[model samples]
Target chain A: MFFHIILERNMQLHPRHFGARLREKLVSKLIKDVEGTCSGRHGFVVAIMGIEHVGKGLIRDGTGFVTFPVKYKCVVFRPFKGEILEAVVTMVNKMGFFAEAGPVQIFVSNHLIPDDMEFQSADTPNYTTSDGSVKIQKDTEVRLKIIGTRVDATEIFCIGTIKDDFLGVISDPSAAV
Target chain B: MSGEEEENAAELKLGEDFVKAKCLMNGEVSLILDRRLEQLQQLSEDPLNQMPQVFEKSLQYVKRFSRYNNPDAVRQVREILSRHQLAEFELVVLGNLCPETVEEAIAMVPSLKDKGRGLDDEAIEKMLTDLALIKSSSSSGHLLKKLGFGLASL
Candidate 1:
């Protein structure tokens, strides 16, 4: 889930970043520092939207680093329980399958799959139904629901299920017609 | 929606509007309920709405959900499941799946297996059958399902 939020941060500018295009320099620094970074509070900062406001520069003693309080809008991605997500199947194994929806890595345990679908080990491990109507393998796009989620400081781990109806393979790359 | 849920929806709206304007976005699935597609459709219809090329192309992704696109039917199905006091997970699964039989509903909701002491199969069958009637009416109205081998044939 992505949320558009205005978050505050204190940006420290080095002496070299002092004049013309200094604001641009500060923005570039902010993006380099903030984007792709994960926090316990805000999942992942996908991108910086726009600068809300930048406060007056506060000079630090001796260090000569100018600190500015910047408020900016950003898109934060956070996964939540019970949300249905469409993800690309990254791997398939005896235990289950691993899928990725953006930065979130989802584990769809075999126990959470529809009873008809079974894991078939081969050159490329896959899970297929008894009737052979549905097949799940690497590069397959699936619709799944998050049963559980844990957001770490660095990454998001999700427990997902495809047992529910309308929550399975959306497209099969291997079986493309 | 409750006050907190409304606030959450408002925040979600802000996120969507940002996605419409700035062209940066993406999801968790559960955070997105079954009902917001209509609102998104309305947003897409707005001449002022500026969606990125990716989002416009990906509108097909939302189209895949045409089966569960009926808000009224979904609400009714959710109500029936809640009246039965089914667990939240079971309710959501049933609402989205719209299972027509006790067996179908049971297949979608594993929670039914553990909570089966008092909840009989017949009761679930009836509720689901009723849901099916409601769902069939709505699904017939959905052009996407009718476009090819209908899910109804399954």
Candidate 2:
């Protein structure tokens, strides 16, 4: 899920960038520094929506650079256990398949797939139902339930399952073609 | 991250931080990101190289999955769903998936089936109908554009 929330950060600015457009410099620098970064606590910071506050600059005794405490609102994506998500399949293998829901990567192991759908190893590897009516391959969109999540400083990985009722391939790019 | 359990817990255990934060639907994110892209293009000649990986992936994901593309339709969809008094997470999930039946909706969002919740099957069915109505109307609008009738009509 995507969230719009305010987060605080301490930004250091060089003496050379302390001219007429100080706020502009700070905003741009904040975007460059903060966007795409992930933290275990808050998940991935996708974009900086707006700056809520910039506290008084505190300068060190020796260095001429100024440190400013900036509070800004941003959009973040995070996945939680038991949360249902729709993700696009990126790869398929014998063990399982990897699908991505925005920045979060989820793995649905062979045990998580329904029993009827058997993995077929061919030129185009995929998991197909007995009747071949339902197929999961590259670019297939699936609705899955996250059973567990591992959050690291820079990334989050999830173990998802499509074995539950109403959780399976939602769209097949191949069928559309 | 600490907060009231009632306020923070969506049927699913979204952590305290996520529950407190305002949730955005795929359609809303797509709109916000599209505007940001336009601004970035105006700012520099080679902005794509400067784009963050997260932003790039999210933009593509939302654009591909967002059910309501137009701002008016997005607003209407929100208004219709908001009337049902759903959790922000549930509302967005329903909006994103656009399930066809009450059983499917309840299945997609199991919280709706939980006891003590006032949302009954009839209400769920009504909400699905309203959502489907908007979806069909918007899709047909796109169909017209694809058929070249939209440009001629304009």
Candidate 3:
């Protein structure tokens, strides 16, 4: 879900960034520093929307660097219990396959997979049905529901299930969906 | 297994070899075996080796049983049904099939119908529901359709 909430971060600037493009440097630095990083409180920082207000830069005593408190609006992606998400398969194994919806890594345990789909050990491990159809392998796009999630300092690990109705593969990437 | 079931099991022994081969092709134990076979197939069929014919039949077996081979699914079913009083093989069947309805669950344990209010009849239903394994009969065609397995006929 996208939120227009404001977030505060302490941004430091080098002496070289004190010239005409100081604000541009600060915004670009903010995007690079925050995007893709997760917080225990919020979720994954998707994109920096706008600068709410940059606090007056405070110069350090001996280092001569300026530290400014920057407030900005950003979009964050967070997976909640029961939230359905479409993700791309990253890796497939005997346990199950791991998928990523942006920054969130979801694990759909074979237990949580529909019983008809069985795990196959091939050059590329995949889950397929008895008829050699409905194969889920690397790069396959899947729709799954988050049953359980554990958000860490930098990453979100989720236990998802595709066994439910309307949850599973969306389309094969090779088929271009 | 009951008296009649025992006789059926004995009768099944006649096709023991055929059954074992079929199981290895598409049963729970094949899940692990298939993984190894896949790796071996890839290695043996390398650019230099190019000897895939060595396990060509096995490759087809792995493909056929790929979906029915997972032991983890059985393990999960076992964990969920451990509270109930049931035999090991019965649990295996339940794990493998993962019946999606109360009617189907009962079908898996049809012997229970004769026992008159057999052990927590509602447990299986609740378990399947809670695990989100029940196929939504009402929805019909959806995910399976996108995968080329339409539900129109079913």
The C-alpha TM-scores of every prediction are 0.56, 0.89, 0.48
Selected candidate, larger DockQ, 2 vs 3: 2
Q: What fraction of the reference structure's interface contacts does model 3 contain? A: 0.00
- Models ranked on TM-score: 2, 1, 3
| Ranking of predictions according to lDDT | 2, 1, 3
lDDT of 1 at B124: 81
Two-chain DockQ for model 3: 0.02
Write model 2 residue lDDT over A1-177, tens digit each, in one string. Answer: 888988999999998998899999999999989999998778889999999999999996799889999999999987767777789999998899999999889999999999998999988789999899899898988888888778776888989999977788875422211
Off by over 4 Å in 2: A172-177, B1-10, B140-154
What is the DockQ for all candidates, taken in turn? Answer: 0.06, 0.45, 0.02
TM-score of chain A, every prediction, order shown: 0.88, 0.92, 0.79
List model 1 lDDT by residue over A31-99, tens digit each. Answer: 778876777555667556679999999999999998999999876665556556567789999999998
- Which stretches of model 1 miss by more than 4 angstroms? A172-177, B1-154
Best by DockQ: 2
Top candidate, metric lDDT? 2
Task: Give candidate 1's whole-model lDDT.
Answer: 0.62
What is the iRMSD in Å for candidate 1?
9.4
Quality of model 3 by C-alpha lDDT: 0.57
